[model samples]
Target: MASQADRVAEAHKTLYDQGLAVRTDVTGADHVHRSLQNGSSDFARPMQELATEVGWGSIWTRPGLDRKTRSLLNIAMLCALNRMTELAVHVRGAVNNGASEIEIRETLIQVAGYCGLPAGLEGVRVAERVLDAIREQQSGEKSSTAA
Candidate 1:
């Protein structure tokens, strides 16, 4: 019989794999994975395990909504919640999931009406940073390819 720790480890691996596939970017996925793990403290381990298994594996792996739609919804929710850090992360995820810059701008505009101006403006700032980073990455990739 597998030990509880072994089972949990296996579950985390499975979920992380699923998350990576949906997220589609190694750096982003690694950031999420590291964040979920919290730290080396034993007390935090279970929370990390549960977050990975349930949040990433169970909810994110659901079939009803595709990754692109989920990314959009996540951006909206993160904005409403005033989670600027997470909003930045999801902005990258949204782009990876096929959201255009225009789509992101429109979403932020919609957020301004319902979630309020402060939250919407903060989201826009984060989106700009994320988009700029993406553009820089693309530029580097192109330059490397050209060489």
Candidate 2:
């Protein structure tokens, strides 16, 4: 059997390949590692380790689901679970993975109709932030090219 650490490393690598790894600027592997290894009593280490391994590593690593589908699934899950904070992160990730503004807006609109206005509103806010980042990046690229 794979050692526990080896399993975790494999999971991290898988998530990285699928663009689902928590970035250094985001959750960083070190923080995730620490949390998995030595989180508070309320935070079960074994379960957390499994989550980092299987959840982030295996499921996220599969090539079957593209980023767009993953984003949609994340939005639905977030709405269902009332996980707005993580929803926002997924929104940004969706944009980084090439989801168009219209697609995101449509997803949010659908969520609003079914989930509730609050969820939709939060999704919109996240979408706006992601869109702004994309626009800024585009502008920066243009300016750099012209210089």
- Which model scores highest in lDDT? 1
Query: Model 2 segments beyond 4 Å from truth?
Result: 1-51
Per-residue lDDT for 49 in model 1?
58
Lowest lDDT block of 10, candidate 1? 20-29
- Overall lDDT per candidate, in order of appearance: 0.81, 0.68
Worst 10 residues of 2 by lDDT: 19-28
How would you encode candidate 2's per-residue C-alpha lDDT over 10-56 as one tens digit per residue? 76666554443633223446545565557445657556655655666
Top of the candidates by TM-score: 1
Model 1 C-alpha RMSD to native: 3.2
RMSD of each: 3.2, 5.5
Summed backbone clashes in each candidate are 0, 0
Q: Give lDDT tens digits, candidate 1, residues 62-105.
A: 98998778888888999999989879888988888789999998
What's model 1's lDDT at 22?
A: 50
Each prediction's TM-score against the native? Answer: 0.80, 0.63
